[model samples]
Target: MFDGFTPEHLALLRGAGVPAAWPRGGVLMRQGEPADRAVLIETGVVKIVSESANGYVSLLALRGVHDLIGEFGCLDDTVRSASVVAMRPVHGFVIAAPRFCALMEENGPLALAILRSVINRLRHADDQRAALGSSTAVVRVAQVLLELSERHGTPAPRWAPKARHLKLTQQELASAAGTSRESVVRTLRELHQRELVETARGAIVVLDPEGLEWWEPEGD
Candidate 1:
């Protein structure tokens, strides 16, 4: 992420890039395509997705403001590893691969920050893979919710009730959790019955974040 960037560093990047926008559901980058540029998200969220030979799609991660997309390709000179789609209307800066590489070479601090971010993401991916393999479906769901909240949630005002609204469809949640839609539906029903979450047309409202985070299957 570029949250740690100083004003000068930000200015350098902005000067080298062009601003772009995408409506919700628009594809920003396609898997296996030439990664000629990288996007630095300034607003809204995007989902990283990958498709298999069988045409099954899997959601890898949710990225929000300040996150860099398609940088892996630029770093390694490879095609895009996954597709990125806008989860909401998005505004960002698009920097050509060559320009981005040049910026890193010209700025030591910016390069170091990018390296740290890459390492952190690799570590987080490893942890998530392990969790998916070892944890129950409910636990995985809870973990995903916690991650979404930490990454994209907007905290309610101090005077307002403590609730967080996440704009994600059940199918998207299922893909992120690495489970089936039926499994996600069952888990949501349980959470709804417990008054921990409320589901609307295409969103989820967390009424008790603590309870959701600590939830475990009965008899566990």
Candidate 2:
């Protein structure tokens, strides 16, 4: 969303909110909470999740720098449908609902940019659901890793200068993959055996992106 913003629009948005920060594991937004404010992330990552009545939490998506979260509930005048939690220490701005709406009403371009962003988000969600329904556990896990690598990965000098490190926990990876942590562990082990990746406590290093991208079960 911020990527599409014009300089004037970005300035307007940044000016509307109060700067804030959240520690790792902080709850930025709670599911079912009353609509109040939206956050514009400037640094770090957050996980969006929806919980079932029986306490089953489904990981919805990950948002990072320049993403706006909690806007949907504020836009539609509804309670929050999901929770946003910080995956790392986060710094951003908190814009109250009324102010946020005012900004949207007064700025046509900003509103249009936000609308396009929402549409893109929905499309991505649809594609992810379709992939989950059709893909094997290993494939799903691999896809999640690839996405994390593409989005948040940085060079891991501790592993190899060229290796890409994905900074996330195994359970987070499983949640994103729509599978069990055990399954993710097994999948990572296999990837390690194939020399495609290396895992530590809370990170994974992509040793071979090309191999991982084209990899499939031997018999498949």
lDDT of 1 by residue, 1-220 (tens): 3345566766777787899999999999999999899898889999899999999888888999878888889878899879999989999999999999998998898888878788888888898899788988877887797678667766654312667777888888899988888988888898888777788788777777887887776667
- Write the residue-wise lDDT of candidate 2 on 105-175 in tens digits: 99888999988888888888898889878999989999889877877777776776567987788887898
C-alpha local distance difference test of each model: 0.83, 0.86
Return the TM-score for each candidate structure.
0.91, 0.92
**Per-residue lDDT for 1 in model 2?**
35
Could you tally the backbone clashes for each prediction?
0, 0
Checking candidate 2 for backbone clashes, the offending pairs are none
